[model samples]
Target chain A: MAVDHNVFITEESIEGETAGPLAGRTIAVKDNLSTAGVRTTCGSEMLADYVPPYDATAVTRVTDAGATIVGKANMDEFGMGTTTETSAFGPTRNPADPERVPGGSSGGSAAAVAAGEADLALGSDTGGSVRCPAAFCGVVGIKPTYGLVSRYGLVAYANSLEQIGPIANTVEDAATLLDVIAGPDPHDGTTREAGADSDYAAAADGDVDGMTIGVVTELFDGADERVVETVEAAIADLEARGAETVEVSLPSLEYAVQAYYVIAMSEASSNLARFDGVRYGHRGESDGNWNESFAETREAFGAEVKRRILLGTYALSAGYHDAYYAKAQDARAWIKADFDDAFESVDAIASPTMPVLPFELGESLDDPLRMYLADANTTPVNLANLPAISVPAGTADGLPVGLQLVGPAFGEETIVRAASAVEDAL
Target chain B: MSETPESDADTADTAAAAAAAVDAEEVRHVAELARVNLADDEVDRFAEEFADILDSFAALDEVPETERDEDLINVMRADEVREGLTQEEALANAAETEDGFFKGPKVS
Candidate 1:
């Protein structure tokens, strides 16, 4: 039997308490997200002993809406890897195949949902973290428009790109979770002011007839044959349902991974700088001065975390600032602009959430480049700050494959509607 | 951005040498800035690994040009001081507190 990776933390059962909206609906939280009084470790030894003082915005919203936090699910240390193998707590195995990895850094959440341990989960999407795992685990995951959900309590990975989103067995369930947590908050300044009142669940059943869908040409060309075949079938299904599929070009799409890594790592380096021994979490045990103690504690962070900090530090380094960091930001603007143009004609863009299915644990664990490339198809949406969802298209060799639908900023309603249609067809 | 030869090398070495360069001292510096502590062996191991991993960053030099007009704007808020947590609530999570302030290990 596959070891259950579900239910990390659960609420004490209250007698006669009818299950809340999420009553009896078990939920798992990604380790990177803060859970008040729970061990939210971000799947790293550095924070193994740390306990958050307050709930993350999503956690508070979900729990308040009657969703129980089963436990902190495993993730890449500080949300860094595409494979959950980087987790200090150990890699979360895919329920489909125990030897294969559950995609990460939201792998645990996806695996929990896949294994039927939880009805739903909350995962942070920073450059496809949520969607990749969902695809690998054959579940539905949504990465809402940037700032759609509050980041006040989310342990920061990349401030501009990361968003708290839902992972569930179906698009409607994911949409339901999004409706509860999507709103403006004083804690997160970047939240969109215009769409604060939108009801995502209500929009799920909206008309898909006559809607224009874009097929990103770049995503399909070099992707795994089986994954592409699955997505192509989804596009065909949409066409049969009266949705028009158009080939839309995002000229700047090629540079997305390059720009995403620079910005994310740069922000991560700065954000993670606050984790030195003095504040919280594990501190180094060295006897030297404050500097040595600080070094010792940091060294304890996983390889992925350290790599990002250094890359970020170097990107922000004085002389190279204009060359690398500034250029990436400019590219980010262009990517956003490309999306704006593409959305002018299309309701949403469809692609395979992941180019390939889940691989065995340790397969890509040592190859960081290969792992980073795993997120290539999904990272562009984050750079454009758009809403996207991964709905299970079909099973390939008994493994789940997700077809991604990406919409313009604040276009959650459209994506949700389209995704719901896709889910129903499957 | 013009690509540098060293940057190309950095991308090629992303998996190996990049992570191998990080050392204990560098980890500590990053930690102090990040506010987390690590044990000594961790520092040494992470330092080497992080260095090897960071080598991929060299590819940033190879990216095409960026728009000069693009600048980051701080999404601003009005300068209004709202009521926040009281002294008691603010100190509630502290390991030690005195006179509504957080108390820490004694400083010389």
Candidate 2:
């Protein structure tokens, strides 16, 4: 069970005996989730010693279905960074290339599956957290429609934008894991009351024949030439399999990253406010008045976490709310409209999961904008509240590329179908 | 993947304009509102970094406004009592507890 990827923050075995579809499978869970008596560090010093009092709904569901809980995986502190470098424990090295990053904040989950440390893993994607890492590590990751999975025990970063997803070696395995962890939860009111159950495993059997796949031209606009070429070749393989292809555009995509960050940060500012060192978070040494101790505790957050909390606070501040938060909501509505129009003409849309190959460890650490820009292709899915899957498409210069298949809201079946085709062709 | 889109020029212009909107003082103020105290050096660093990030976000300004739908209802189920966590379980993870309650700093 020892994988040198540094994927898990805490590696311990928990037994599960209820026989179900995922029987005998091992699952690596991101540390941000609540697991009773297990340390959920969330890749931050703020909760280094904190253990949850109860299990996350997803964890309970999977363990109830006979999946063993392997360990708590590392992540970007509170899921804020594009690279796992922000982890307070240590950055997870890409199983494919140690010198490069395993895309984050679900970097450890992807690395765990890619390195064979775990049979399947749970990752939460707010923007591109799950898919980006899956792309870099050459695995399949699914970000179900916004409310498809219950977020009851997932620690909040951006409540409206995040969902717990599956990362697995194969699409079938991913679907199996999804079936176990996904369903409506009374604890999380945001979860959809119905339409949560789907036989994703069955959906993976269909061919892409007669399916109209739209290539997202915007996704290719600024990607590396080799990466683009490799993805196009994958598309050509799909064409050879009898699928029709057409070029499509989501012009509002030009503004997705910006809008996503603004809304995410704003929500983060409010969600993170609860971590004041009083109840469960890390408490400070000083025994002074409540305010000073609270301030000292907040100072323990990682740099990226601080950056997001500060920026978010700025955006939601009185004089700026109209210019930033409101505008971002408008942009979100526009992006959703664009997706509705695109779906009218095409069954699904395809894009390169990320613009470039996984970069070096410290390449974009200091340039926050560059890290934010890398999420362009993936963020629109969150804004539009649709289902998307990232399957290993091809390799450019040895690093794996991911082909993203996006379908309409609650259209997991269509995305799973197209992704399975690409997964087989590649 | 590192290539900039055709709108790079416009992005640069927005960055330049937005940079002036955030300063060290603004960063410090926001940090205070969030209940975090930033060291003087952090204030300066965050000020410059946030300006760049905010500039990127300004692209939302180009979004046209749309009419809000009035039919959106707060998705709520019938309010009924359900099985829930006990007080002991809720306070089990607290750093300090007294009289079956989470202990905290004394309020003024």
In candidate 2 the C-alpha lDDT for residue A287 amounts to 82
TM-score of 2: 0.94
Candidate 1 CAPRI-style tier = incorrect
Candidate 2: which stretches are off by over 4 Å? A1-3, A193-196, B1-19, B68-72
Once model 2 is optimally superposed onto the true structure by TM-score, how far is the C-alpha of residue A182 displaced, in angstroms? 2.2
lDDT of 1 by residue, A35-127 (tens): 656667888877886677677777777777777666678888888998788888787888877878888889888888988877888999999
Question: Which regions in candidate 1 have their CA more than 4 angstroms from the true location?
Answer: A6-24, B1-64, B68-108
Query: Model 1 chain A — which ten-residue stretch has the worst lDDT?
Result: A7-16
For each candidate, give the interface RMSD after superposing the true interface residues on Cα: 5.9, 5.1
Residue B98 of model 1 has an lDDT of 72
